[model samples]
Target chain A: MTETVIQTRGLTKEFIRDEFHVVALDRVDIDIRKGEFVALMGPSGSGKSTLLHLIAAMDRPTDGEIRVLGQDLRGLSDREVSYWRNSHVGFIFQSFNLIPVLNAIENVELPLKLTTLTKKEQREHAATALKLVGLEERMRHLPRQLSGGQEQRVAIARAIVTDPDLILADEPTGNLDAASADEALNLLAKLNRDYGKTIVMVTHDPHAAGFATRVCHLEKGVLLESLQADGS
Target chain B: MMRISNFLPLVFKNSFRNRRRSILTVASLALSLCLLGLLMAMYEALFYGPDPTPAQAVRLVVRNKVSLAQPMPLSHEQKIRQVPGVEAVMLQQWFGGTYRDARDPNNFFARFAVQPQEVFSIFSEYSLPEAERQAFVRERTACVASRTLADKFGWKTGERITFVGDIFPVTVELKLAGIYDDPNQNEVLYFQWEYLRESLRPVFGGEMDMVSQFILKADSPESVPRISREVDEMFAVTPFQTKTESEQAFVLSFVSFLGNLKLFMLAIGGAVTFTILLVSANTLSMSVRERIREVGIMKTLGFTPGIILGTLLGEASLMSLTGGLIGCAFAWALCAMISSAPIPFAQLRGLALTPLITLICLSIAILIGLGSALLPALNASRRPILDSLGHSG
Candidate 1:
């Protein structure tokens, strides 16, 4: 039997702006099992990112339950949520947000700082993660010293350094050139296919969505359909 | 749940992220603290001089009742000597005169005509050889200067110096008999009272019989207050009324001539501190504002609000502490130079930057750092992660 990695039943999120209540996500239902590369497809402001945020425990839903890795996220305190998120989830951003001062290996080592790992062990784990992303040569380079694609690779190294159970990426390739974007998408696909890592990536690009095992479309705060990718 | 110690490297790196801004902020803090330290040192020296030694505690000064400018008749010294608890008595008259250059302030120091026979017995804190003391007492034209004063002017034994008197229309020449050392490094010169009395009598005749004040020592510390009262009462009905006080109180009264110095220094210090706080707050606010997205990134990586706030606060404290150390060192060096510059003000002769002053200044620097960063760090820590990530800065 396949285990469900993420389950959201009638999950809703609403934001209030200047005396008006705006609904970002309305009672959306989603189910993602282990080792599934699910791509959330939608236009801007379509709440696909909001669903990913809710599942990642980066935000709270207004009206339904969200459980990730069989743990009820709504029951966790802020501090508990932080520790749980650090241990269980890896997040990547579109802008390749690395701490400008730390080198590539140090950026990858940030997640392990919260653990009880010794400094040597943390460096060893970070170096391995960087090697996995093919950034072994750039371990001592700062973010500004790297190209956009190389910086994105460092971000990927940081995300997976903790050996998290699930990886969530929001517009991971939106700022990259075509060749860099393809390299990043190929990396995500390889992680899911070879390592059996569960990934939920948010993107408006259909070509990027094609790299996922399943595609779920969201429009106007509503989930339309979940379809398997043609290759899968 | 992160230990603050783990954040030190991050804190240190962030402080230098914008090197120019950090340096400017530290320089401003250092300058302000330097001024504050100097003012505090002066205040400490004036108000809290080292506690009186055992011999000093039993000594008293008798002056005119109304004002320091009023001269008391010489007969009061005999009556003061006869007091029950009085151990010894000496007369001292201030001779306000210039050395070589009357126009230059650096040529000024304390000069007094004192009873040379009683000088060593009355001021037991001073130390010199017995031969020098005997020469100073026997020769009416001889003068004794403290080692600090002698070093300032390069005067040696047998060197002749003349002073053109300012208060009395008379000029006197004297030979240097000895150089003595005192703990406070006071720049003072004392000459025989008979030299000044003879010089004055040729001009003002019998008016030269008057003297400025009398210094007396009691048999013990317990008898100081009683001796003061008895001496003052003995001269009450006479032509020369006397005001008697302990040696420490006498020095403090001279300091009072400058007005309330404590309040003055505190007011300036408070203003400077407030200005530095505002400057520091603004600089830290801009630094944190520029790093809003970075803070969000750290939060997504599992840094709690407490951790973020503590790290930023730590950065501020570390930067300000560096500035404080530099400022204290500057102030200490400046005070050393000033103390050796031959200033005539006795209150500032031995001004010093004590360890207690340095500790206090450093603590204030830390407090300033913490106070300046509180609002900005709190705001950054509590901001919603999504909003922070979305921030353009």
Candidate 2:
């Protein structure tokens, strides 16, 4: 066991839309040791995404403690949370979500900008990350010029360029074709197996969730089941 | 080093991507500079204009008490000399003239009758040799022509020029003597004052010694106002009154009649400055709108909002500064071309876009740039990460 990189206790998330209060997550306690591959599976609006956002420090939890590398996110300011997110966490979203203006290399180099690393060092890291994702040769191509899968690879490169310990992936293959989604899932699997990075991924697609070592099913703001032996 | 190096190409490409808009903006700045330059140049020409000053040292003009139109007694020439400021005395009448060749007379200009011997003494800036100046005094029919007037008639030194005098009700022909120009003086013309007096033999029974006006002088500008006041007081009790002022004040006083055109010029300058501000702001706003996604990405990457805002404002200032420099260069060229002109408000034209003026213009560009960029940058910087992250466009 490397360590317990992230720990959460009694987490709850509420969504209010048009004066309607909807409980997205209810008093859910989860613990995973470092180097864990945990998939959060649920249908749309099943609090999977909300739980991901809260744990990633992208949103403040209404109640309970969520800690990344032992830093409690409860009272952290926006800037503080942003700093923590930039340095400690990497994200792979369902959408490719790349800046159109920047090329693949520049997009990869984006998160590295937050580090105090030198420009040359940042570029080297970004290039290495793209190479790891097997897209080094496509560095200079803009998002428009790249395919959907390639853009997602670039996004993954950007997320990992900072070498963050925890990679939070939310429906990383939601926009990809089956072939491309297979490629993305394989990459994530390889990242978890080889690099020993802890990953907490949320997905509606069972095939996408198949890549994780364990899958947690959530229903109506409650954890329904935890299925282990899921290395599909 | 790469960060800085990369910024240049990126900024340059983006700034000029809308090529037509950028060029039109540059040209607009240039046109403003041109207009400003021409106005300043013409003003300089009319005031300390490039045309040489007329006889200032050796000769002086004696005028009546009340004004320029009145005549002064010829005997007063000796009395004027007795005054400490007066070195020599000459007589001149404004010879309002059309042209002898009215069929197609060239540009309109005026000529004056001058006391030749003392003309160069009183108008020391005039560059006539003492010999020619003396000859003009001795010869009753000799006249000194300005270059523009001489150029019109194809006249040369020692050649004769003729004019149909409107004031005297007769035709006047005078011998041309040594072309002249005075570096320190302004617009003027001169012929022998005695020639006019002698030429008037039929009208005043050779009593043309009664001079139309007199030119006064002092050793320095410091003495001018005092001597002017004293001279006026000397004729205070006489039937004729006197008015005296420095030549510059005399010339500038005429500017008042156009009814605060200087203020109008100031208003025009303000309007130009205001327009540049608006232009810069609009450009910045549009640029910000285009870069929303890029900004969002930057924020997610850990770039602080301050950095994003600074970068955008810096870009705006950079563009405006470049445009301002081109404008200043255009203004410099225009100023050089019209440094010498014959317009009435010469002081107001040929205005030098001095280093300070250039800085001011560029600074205005920068201020406008930053001012316009502030809001857009703020909007972009504070934009929620989610909105931009989710932005389809």
Candidate 3:
């Protein structure tokens, strides 16, 4: 039962643009168990990312309820949401968005900066995270100095630096080549298996999606399929 | 907070990022401060009170029947001294001379020839110790000078000082017997009255009787106006009409000219403050624009509206204080250099470091810094986070 780490009841997200309403999510209802690794699959216009954003508390749903890790997110202030994000949730963006000025260790240390963590501890954590991504030797390298896969690995290192319970990755491999995608996915899979982290990913590639234990699809703004994992 | 300590250096780095603009701003501030300080020092020089008027019981100035430029007779001193409140009478005459160094002329104050014994008594800025006074009166070749004139020629006690005489036409060589300073009366660089009297006994050219006004002292303040009236009445029958007034009133008349100069300086000070305000505001605006996204990031990172606003303003104030300090230091340094230069009016004393002046000047800088920062900082605070995250657009 794992206490259902995420539960949404008839959740919806709608954006109003120039007198027309764009429904980005429609009547989404799901229960994702604790420690589960799930993939949300759809093309660009699908509701995958919107659902991911709602569950991550990055934005509020237009209607209905979302309970993430047993806490209803609608009542959280932006500050509380930021606090929750820093302490409880992790995000890996598709672009591997690393601040260009900060070196790999600093980028990994970004989330911890808002905490009362001592400087030495923050460095230790960032170094350990970078080492997990096998880029410890390159901790001092800037983002521009790193190859695309290394930068993506640095981004993953940043995501879990705070030891968040749930890792929400938006197209974690969308920008990487096949090898880098494999590496990013392997890292995510390792975080789930090794650290027992709850993982939810939004991606367009089925090959990338195949790495997850379950797959879900959306058509237009509607969730169309929820299927159990069948093959590698 | 780490933010505040780190934030100031970041603001300073903004100035360095665009060195040209920062230099222009600093230069303008320094120049304005320099000019303001110079004006204040000059005005102080001009209004220096009767610096130690002689304690002589009864002495008076006998000027014209009408105005100051109209000098009165040496004979008028004799008649004025005979009046009830008067004690002793003697004469001194002004010899307005340019310096021997014609390369920089107009370095003129006043030189007077006096009956040496009565000279120190009548005008009394001409003080020598009793022995030196006796020796000075005994020898026509001897003269005494104000401390300022002595220092000007690098002359010490017993050293001979000379000036190219303008009216007398002879290079007057005189001994500096002692240093002089007076908080009242006038500072007169003087030689014997016999020189002007004897020298003029031959020329006898123009107004033979007139001494450039006379210095008169009353037994008390109550008698000043009455003594003044009788002196004017005595000269009324003569050709030169006398306008007698208290010494204080005489010095006060020059205040009108100085007042206009003060008004002009105040206008410049106003402009200085206003210009710095615009410059600092522009600097703040540019700085805020560059960090618009960081503002958004800060907001999203849980910093409050007040935190953003306060940080912006604090940075601005710090900038102003730094600029103010530099400008003030520049003004002080310039004053020191000018004080040491060969300028008579410059040796005119004032503390180059006046707290009120620094406070007011730096106050302008801080005010300008804060005022300029306000709109831009407020604008940055109210901007939507979405717009900020998108930097270029």
Candidate 4:
């Protein structure tokens, strides 16, 4: 059996708004194995992104336990948590959250700075990551100088440059056009298949979900069902 | 250990993220610091007058006990000279007069009726050629001008200068016998007290026998305070009582005429510091608030809270340090320029931004930078990553 990379038991998240208690995620239990591409599908405000954040340790669960890569997140200090996330997780956001001031190559080089890598080695690694995302020629351009597709590709390069064990992407193609969205989804699929990266992506588009090995549906903060993708 | 050096480039770039705002902020800091530096220099000048030379350190002045304008009887000079440590004594009087026009501040300088025979003996620091000294002593209708004063009025050794008196009723005339150099007393003209007395004798009916002040020197610096007290006590019961003090103390008493200047400078300095603090805080707050989303993005990229806080503080400090250096350099240049020109006021001649003042200004600037950004940086660092990522800005 492949090792379980992500495990949650009765995971819950709550928010208080204007003196009203709101449950963003309720009693969610899920397990993701190594090298699996899982797509979490839901309408807006359905807590899919909330669950992904919990797994990535970007947000804490209000109740229950979350264990990623055999380490219980609640047991770690904030500093240790940051080190863990940097070493083990790569996150891609919907808006292609590239630092506007940095050029494409510098953006990819951001995470490598946290390591002991020399400047030359960091540059070589970032270049390889960009080439993997098919953005090798656009490395010197600023985000404003790139198209939405190119910008998202640059963000993808930034995520994978660290060689993290798990990739968490939240609506990575929501802002891209049809062609760009297809290209981004294809890249995610290739990273999971060829690179053997365990990826958990949250998206509402069924077309994007079809590229994953397994699909899960979330509604009103509840995980309803999980099923294998027929073609994949 | 996380190295802040890794993020220095990011901090530098972020400092200039909004060029207009950054430039305006730096300009505001620079101007405020410049004004503050000048204020500190003024306080330094007034509170602590010029340092006395070895000659000046042993000299004392005797004036009327009640007020500086009141005259002391000339008879007191003999008793003062008889004191145990007294080396020499000279009769000195302020001759308030107009040269060309008293209305012009540029024409202002210290004009004194002094005992020419005894002046050099008492103020031994003044330097004059032996021939000029002989000429000055021989000719009773002769005066000596300081090198600075002669250069100001373009006066030569043989030129005759007349003073239209304001205190006495007669005009006095004298020839410039020589120019003397006294670095500590730059703007002054000293003439024979006997000539002034003769000019005033007809109006006062006699030798105008009262002196404005008597300047005396003690044999040693250590005995100056004792001699001052002894002189004042010797004339304690006389109708024209005397108040004696060292030259430095006399200069300080003159500065005290400006009211409680130390307290005033302190209040102004406090107000300026607070104002700059507020301005800096507002600027950093705005800059951080606008970058909330970006901070969250970095947090998501696994930057710790400490790193975030440090980076922002580093940016603020860099900006403020730049402003501080420019402001201090500007103040130093201004002081140098003013020192080159003639300062109408004697006490303000040596105004400058000392090294201590520069260090203090730079320290305040850095404190303002760090103090202003602390709260905003703390809040941004501690804010939840989810909310930061969800933020539109």
Which numbered prediction scores highest in DockQ against the true structure?
4
lDDT-superior candidate, 1 or 3 = 1
Between candidates 2 and 3, the TM-score winner = 2
lDDT of 1 by residue, B121-169 (tens): 9899999898998899999999999998898889998889899998988
| Pairs clashing within candidate 4 | none
Among these predictions, the greatest TM-score belongs to 4
Give the distance in Å from residue B78's predicted Cα in candidate 2 to where it truly belongs.
8.2
What residue runs in model 2 are displaced by over 4 Å at the alpha carbon? A10-29, A74-82, A93-95, A114-119, A216-232, B1-110, B145-155, B160-174, B184-188, B194-214, B228-243, B255-257, B340-350, B390-393
Q: Score every model by TM-score.
A: 0.95, 0.81, 0.74, 0.96
lDDT of 4 by residue, B1-393 (tens): 445577888889889889999998888888888888888887787667667789999999899999889998888888888999999999899998888887887787888999888989888889999899889888888999999889888999999999899888878888999999986757889988888888888898888878889999899999998998899889888898898999888877777767787788888888988998999999999999988999898988888899889999998998898788888888888777776666654556677999999999999999999999999999999999988887776
The CA lDDT at B265 in model 4 is: 81
In lDDT terms, how accurate is model 2?
Answer: 0.72
Candidates sorted by DockQ, best first: 4, 1, 2, 3
In terms of lDDT, the poorest run of 10 residues in model 3 chain B is: B1-10
TM for candidate 1 is 0.95
- Model 1 lDDT per residue over A119-194, tens place: 7888999999999989999999999999999999899989999999899999999999999999999999988988
